[model samples]
Target: MKALRHVLRATTVREAIDRVPEAFYERFAFAFLLAWLAAPLLLWWVGPVIGTDITFLAWVNLQVGLGALILVALRLAAHLVPPRDVSWRVVLRDELPLVLLGMFLLLAVLATALSPTAEALDGDWYRRESIWTFAAYVGFFFLASRVVSGVLRRALLAGVIALALITCIVTLVAAISAGWHTDEGAVAHRAIAYFHQFNHYGYLLAVACVLAAAAALTVARRVLRGGLIAVFGILLLTLLLNDTLGAYLAVVAGLAGLVTWLAVLRRLHVTTLLLLAAVAVVVHVLADALGVGVAAEIASLGGDMVAVSEGSADAASAGTGRWGLWMITLEQIAVSPWSGHGIEGIASLLPGGYGRPHDEYLQYAVFFGIPALIAYVSAVVVVLVRVVRRGRAVDGITVCATAAAFAYLISALFGNTMYYTAPLLFLLLGIAWAGVRAAGSELLDAESTPLAEDRTAPTPII
Candidate 1:
């Protein structure tokens, strides 16, 4: 024991971290760890604050501010140690468009604040918030990329799964204790698991499911596979219990996207594809036969497909009618087609003081005009094109990251998920960028070394 203690004391930080097992270098892992650590406080305060119209947005804003401070501190510490060739320029290269768009919005907000029509320009809450949120995420990505160690990455992943499991368990316990039921008289026994809204819960579960699936595929050891399967089961069960149509659709879409991408690349086995197709068909038939509500109840603790649908009756009717709200938003956007109202102009556009557009694209056009929307779209398109082109030559991890990006892009169309969707978009983008960097490094190494081909084996295709 004394010898073991001496060895542990002698080990370097990196070596000690390496001994922890799992990839500790991934940003998602660290983000997940931080998020989980922060969840209880967030949950306790957010609902109450939002209920009182105190702007829970400030909570996230505070987190972003603190993250910036932490990032600077980490950078300073890194400088004291052996300097690595970490390049902020590379980060800027990938994220320049987002930065430019943010600047445009900032200018717009400033212009609106100073304008004679300043009071009329309050309709751009979504736009202003989204711009700041995007900036915060970009900052988070930079910090996470730099500070994450290999052990921390692995721990983050494991920690995220563990936290998700805990959330599921807590949700289950709460439901059981409360004996809660939906408005339609169906027991929502497991539906609200650790989340106040079904959609949020579903989104979180969907991410867990994807990560769990990735682990199942990539982890070689049987023991690890078994553990991942157990975790996957817990997450899947939580998702079903939540009964969120958007969440359900997103999960289906993500899985389908993953399989379809793999098939197109000829990386997936024909037998597995056939089996999945057969299962899908069987499930569809069963669901149809069971009646929509009954099927929903059986598949998820929540009942009624209609209840799960986006802009459901409760949501649409309760919040000044989203459709009506959107119509007003569109009218505001039409007022200034070129540069629209400034970022602050959105709130002023609303007849009554409504906060958000509930839609990202609409908010963008309303706040910064068509120019900003074009820039945002152009950025997404560039990322997509690069991902597709580079992914073909990379490993499974790269392929998965690309596929996840596609899923997020699709989901973004229906929801204001860009930055509001936690770290999903930023995390995927970071992974995709990391893959690109790795591939570039490999090519540079090959070019510099005459015997590179002999020294390094070809990167195995997914």
Candidate 2:
């Protein structure tokens, strides 16, 4: 009778879920994440080489969609087998950003259904950011929020840091050995590394630098903190070598965001300030040595502005050729204010055979309409605001994740949504979401109790 009662004690679905070992969920999350992270490296090693368009796209399509499909299937099975009593009110109040993401996905589907071209519905051959991809992204995000926690979460972050370090080190070695100039005779060739696009490489470095900087600042272990500082130095140096202006600006913006948040929480100390100042000095010195100093880049930008102001015919050709493309995209957005053309829909409309708008906000509006864009931006803003306002000062995950997201947003202004980089940004955002949820207290506001008053609190080394 006692055994029967024990078995029957699992009345709620939440209780049934709790019956399973916690290790099971952690292992499942780790396996899924490992496979996803390894996909790119595996492709680079044995899969299709660049310029073999069809085979490369086929491989990428399979790699990107496979893990996501498995995750979706697992999530569905979990829901079907043990239905939990969900409080819709609580979800609505607490998970507003996630709800907004869902709305964005739905709006994207609507846009895809009403797409004018077949390419828009299925995505173009090169950049296959179809509706399916967006759906998978959203699913992965929601699942990440559930499974990624505690030790597994820290492991995932460490893996990401290691990946970034490996990539930057390899790129630096290549640049040193293989002449740093490209065929077009540019001063210093941009570092594309294993990825096809230099800007994509820039995106990775920019985010990694912010994460490393945050970890170095907050981690309590002396050796670990020193290692993180070294990692930050390498990342910053590689970022300078990558030499993408948008990425440079992104790193600056991200660091600024991190410092500002720390200051707001009253966590900024003299040591941290001195460390940051030293980092800045090192960056300037390295930039000068690399022959891609700040002054040179600024002069180039000024020259472009001057040409544009003087109405030069070739002004549109200067500085990434983005001015003309942005103008054209704005005009098209006005035409289709409600129903968008769908993913990669504006390719035909764009001049010079360009496939993307070179701007993420414009890309979102063009592909999925204005409402979708608003929903996506709103979700990001809400998550960012929540992390800055409510996350505890000792929570390194929240600090690093928020900083990385900020960097990505700033970089996205000049770079289009990339298939490789977009997933990373979403993952960081998801981790941030999870960190916010795991605060375990209603008194979670960082501003309510400053770090100075709570010096003995434990800090997670993530």
Candidate 3:
């Protein structure tokens, strides 16, 4: 009765908002990201029985739930706090990429509503990347950019590496137990791990491997650096176990981007460059010795390239059947460039039972219109530019985020986004933006302070 009486006299909404520190929502947002990362792994245990579609839907709902919470917290804070507050001003100044992403989401909603075949809010039954999911993605991005700092940043970085390590270990065990071959006498090439498809798992491995490698190169602490290297080696091994050529190319592109960016900043030593080359050679040799069949995949890819170059009609029938599908997708986009046919619009146009265009950029244009694609691509470009502008003031985690983004974008050229992996991509983007803001603030403080009085100069953070 006394507890009930006290509850009846609880503080009003405004008073409660005043009592709660902003850090609470930040912590909550951090937890939301962690949960999103771990959900697929947990669901993997029962994925065989329940089906991948269910797992995908579960992820979508989780994103919407947690993302909505963070958004609500922001609205409450905005209503109670003054607009001119330092933090509010900072957010407004550094939220351009997020703003562009929100624009894409709004345009997606319009496309969906105007869709002739797709349901108003819900997309197709297969991969339902509806307006609701895109809204959640934007909200998650906003919250991450706002709060990913200090300890939270470190935690998120560690989480990504740890998840990669765990996935590699489990995948190796499964492959070994299966004798690395199917009963059909063919090699069991693709290591699915926790994802429903080999390609989806490949996307995650690509990003994580790149991020881990970049972090290992720049991190100052010896133990952490060694651990990251080990994680990178394991991820590379697992990647080789699978025959996802797009993933292999993505890793190379990501590392190249990382090395090039660091060289531009004058942060990478000649010795570090040699070490990276040596590591690549070692991984290649190891994969060859283990009979990973990567060479055969590469040779096949090369043959396809040659076939296409010679103008062979067989190029239309080449491996992966992507050439013809791409042509069809281009034709469809030409028909409806401004307002797309809606989510999963390519399904009806595809031949040979293909669903998606297998290219993320084209898929976006097919589903949500050319404007939406431009907005999303611009957002990604803005993220890279923002981090680059931070220069040497950026930290090791930000460097990892940049490489991961490169890996994801490159891989997306040959693959579509998965519900499980897209959130991780957005999380890295948010972290990258957060790092840019923090680095800018550090530079600002250094400039404001006198040289003699500024004991803490803006040195390159590792």
lDDT scores for all predictions?
A: 0.51, 0.69, 0.72
The C-alpha RMSD of each candidate to the native structure, in angstroms, is 9.4, 5.9, 5.4
Q: Give the better candidate number (1 or 3) by lDDT.
A: 3
| lDDT for each residue of candidate 1 in 1-462, tens digit (9 for 90 to 100) | 553464477458655432432222234235643673455445544757656322344345437535755644543343443224535564455455445545544545544544434333222333224344545655544443332233343444555466567777777677557753544457444445434446556666676666665555444466776676666666665565565555556667777867766667526645434544454455455434433332544354232334435545554332224455676778877877667675545665554645446566776676667676776666556555655665345444444455555555555544454223545555555444444443333522222333332232222110
Best by TM-score: 3
- Model 3 lDDT tens row, 185-249: 46444457656667777888899889888887777767866777777878887887775788999
Ranking by lDDT: 3, 2, 1
Point out the higher-scoring one by TM-score: 1 or 3.
Answer: 3
Alpha-carbon shift of residue 136 in model 3 (angstroms): 2.1
> Which candidate ranks first by lDDT, i.e. highest?
3
Cα lDDT tens digits, model 2, 1-462, are: 553455468887666544444335435655666556666565555555543432253345444446545644544444543324545454454567778988998899888888756764465666666677777667556545544444555566676778789888877787888756633466446556566677778888888888888777766676887788788888888877767788888989888878877877747655855775687679779768767566677688889889899989988766778878887788889989776777787787777667778899999898889999999999998888777767354366667777887888898988887666776777778767766653345333332333421232212111
Give lDDT: candidate 1, residue 239: 64
Candidate 2: TM-score? Answer: 0.83
Model 1 weakest lDDT span, ten residues long: 453-462
* Residue ranges of candidate 3 with Cα displaced over 4 Å: 1-10, 46-57, 60-66, 69-73, 76-82, 85-92, 116-120, 123-125, 182-189, 269-276, 438-462
Residue pairs in clash, model 3: none
Model 1 misplaced stretches (Cα beyond 4 Å): 1-61, 69-134, 145-159, 184-196, 269-327, 338-355, 392-406, 417-420, 438-462
